[model samples]
Target: MKNLIFSLPFFLTLFFGTHVNAQKISDGQTIEINGMSVTFNILNKESVEAGGKPYDRYKVSATVKNASDKGYNIRLSSYPQIVSNIGLVELNCINATGAKLTSKKIELKMKAQMINVSYSAYDKSGKFTTNMIPITGSYYFDPGDTISDNAIFIVPQGEKPDVSVRNLR
Candidate 1:
């Protein structure tokens, strides 16, 4: 009973704290990412569908749109990023063969790459719920492309998002 009492407060704080600090992200919020006009939308979901299949998961999806006239490359890990109020904790999923990050390459070609992403969803703790994920990932984005990919940790926790996707100059 004593242990429960002690842990109850901790659990409550973590639960309620998530709500208290979640910054409202408007739909189609345009921001400058990698020297491009990037529009993003965040979605809370119990599970995400990918590759014509579905699985159980708990995470947020940041539907990103590269509204630029150029292409950009982004790196994705084998797992999701743990984002708190402080910021996104490093969740680099790079390793060797047979690893989820083995093919960590994402290529974006304007509207061509805007097709629905076929990657599996995972927990924020870097656990994969499905096997349909990119290996050796390196994302390339072109101008005027809207891609709804759930491969990031957009949780504000209790602070503003401090993750910057700077363009390669």
Candidate 2:
């Protein structure tokens, strides 16, 4: 009886204090990344060369348009950044016969806040080009990886920015 009395308050708090289905919060407004009033235009993607060989690695790219009056810096980390916030961004290239081809790794990069960041993907050649797909790995943008950054540009209020991924031999 004593133990029940002691635990009653705890149980009550747990049962009553929690919300069953609270609505998610939203700002309804977009914020500039890395102090740059730029907008991402393209999330381009393609197959990439892996380990100096033409493998079935899918390459991912993102393009941002500067909308700020001054030069705006941007980086991959400023966005979802690989397999982090958005989980693994995956692309698949499969063959008709259901046979696996082969794949390799490719570098990715973005520049923001005056800093450059890079990322990489693995090759899955045996999977086939038709099924050649790329996704987010368990890694984020790091230094010395393939990356792209647009020069500081004075974007007018209505201009758009762009970014993309390329498939290279």
Candidate 3:
């Protein structure tokens, strides 16, 4: 009886702990973390030419709102990633084989006069870039304020992968 009682608590903890730590979010789903409400979704997919090369681009969007009464600074630890049958593919510049493609990571120089900055991939110059949530620095959010941003993921030709947002909090 004593063993059963002790094992019951352990089993319960194992079950609930895994549930809380599963950070994978799907399209149009919202999750609340640290008094902030965040929603992630894939908006659309299209073909585009970047730097004279043709590739498939997926547009993923994220919406974040300050639910707390007090203002605070927030930033994403990592951007959303493309998951395929092989594995999780990250944003990179090098192209690899085996049903997976590489993505480009943009490095930007922060201007001294800029405050409350956001990112986007749409440039008039036709260069490939991702307009992602600011992972470089924290942005201040007032109470009840919301911010929406889009990220463009470039994949190899004819490859469509599922998107997943993890460790967003």
Candidate 4:
């Protein structure tokens, strides 16, 4: 019983360690998740003044491609994270003049056909129009579709941070 108890913990750790390890991804590398290929890269980094304080600004780009035959709806805005020696920094956008910048989250919808009909008996001028309103917080990907967008993240000055994208499966 004593030998079994000692070996059981070791065996359990060995069994679970492989599954718990996260795959380390380098910069500008692409990973496929659920038939969607995601690529994240830090384009540019510089020092900028935001809210009267110096901060590090990063221009990051993310691209997603749908390689599957089916469509998928996924959110890409919340996937990027910045980590430094001080730990995870809050991601936000700020301009050079210390003004907070608001970036629109990229949301894509699968292309679909829509039919609009107008039936007017007394009106001589009958027109059909389609209006599209942008929706926030989600995006849809169709087969063979690709999209790329750039965002800015500001962090404290003098901090060297690394960008990582959370797995989107």
Candidate 5:
């Protein structure tokens, strides 16, 4: 009987341990996408005062892994926009100065998933850009590698909307 009681506590922890790491975020949530593991968390956002102007901004981080023994290419792209869900927008990147950079759109073939939009960057300039800035095709993760996503978003001027992000396994 003593052994049974002692084992009961251990059993509970094993049964519920997997769910303890799941998380969620707002319209612009930082999600980690790896094989058999995904996590979501709300991003910390703020505007930089440059030339006396405010640029709306927020950032989310993600890590991707190749996991396979061989060299593999991983492409990180946006999911779709949430539909009929007010006060929400999807953006791919933000610069160090807090200005949103325009980019080429990425289409995620998320098999009939509920996500609504995928936004990537379109770099028309041939100059090299890096750090706290939004640029497309600037970085890509490789085998046995992890990287930060740095997803960004802004509230439409003069209006605020409620949002919720669901973390899916």
Candidate 6:
């Protein structure tokens, strides 16, 4: 009884301590593509002060890992509206901003998937309400690499926006 009782504390400590000290997984979501691992996490968004106005914004970060030995040419949005595996990537433009962005349009050049999924959309609510909004910029990825980026979004004061990517084309 003494040995069993004494060992219980040590065993419990070992198991519980490891789990407690383990790395904190943001969003705890992962998606694989072309043998690459993509982990998605809700970024620690900050208040944005644009156009002489300060507003809170939402952003998501995606970490891609190229595990394959062969180098694959991949293009990803540093601020993809939706980090999904269905090739339905987008950039929320209701409150999105980036350096070198074109004043006319913001193209989401997601030229990675086999299908021709070129489009855009808007983000205005806290839910998944996708829109086809144009974007700008060109970014790509390669093999044996791990990269992460954030996408900014807007959640209007009272609207319940859709969180799912929409085929608003």
lDDT of all predictions: 0.38, 0.29, 0.52, 0.52, 0.37, 0.44
Give the residue spans of candidate 1 off by over 4 A: 1-28, 45-58, 71-140, 151-164
**Model 6 misplaced regions, further than 4 Å:** 1-26, 45-56, 73-142, 156-169
Which portions of model 3 show Cα errors greater than 4 Å? 1-22, 47-55, 73-139, 156-169
Please provide, for model 3 over 1-49, each residue's C-alpha lDDT reduced to its tens digit, 9 standing for 90 to 100: 9999989999999877645544545567887766766676668988777
TM-score of each: 0.28, 0.17, 0.41, 0.47, 0.27, 0.33
Clash count for candidate 5 is 11
Clashes of each: 18, 43, 3, 1, 11, 21
Per-residue lDDT of 1-169 in model 2, one digit per residue for the tens?
9999999999988765533211121112222343322222223323334344332222222233334344312234334464223111111111211113322211222332333334444447644233333433233333222233222211122322222222210
User: Cα miss at 50, model 4 (Å)?
Assistant: 2.2
> Would you list the clashing residue pairs of candidate 4?
51-98
**RMSD list, candidates in order:** 17.9, 20.1, 15.5, 12.3, 18.1, 18.0
State how far residue 112 of model 5 sits from its true place (Å). 32
Model 5 C-alpha lDDT per residue in residues 51-143, reported as the tens digit of each score: 466544545443333454544332335422232221111222212233455221111212121323344454568555442433332123335
Give the alpha carbon lDDT tens digit for every residue of 46-142 in model 1: 4334444443222323334555566554554543543122111111112211122222211222221122346567778989865443333444555
Model 2 local distance difference test score: 0.29
Q: With candidate 2 superimposed using the best TM-score fit, by how many Å does residue 46's alpha carbon deviate from the native?
A: 9.3
Superposition TM-score, candidate 4 onto the true structure: 0.47
lDDT of 4 by residue, 15-89 (tens): 666334333334487877667676767688888886688878767676767778987554434323231221111
Stretches of model 4 off by over 4 angstroms after superposition:
1-26, 73-99, 102-140, 160-169
Distance (Å) between predicted and true CA of 131, model 1?
27
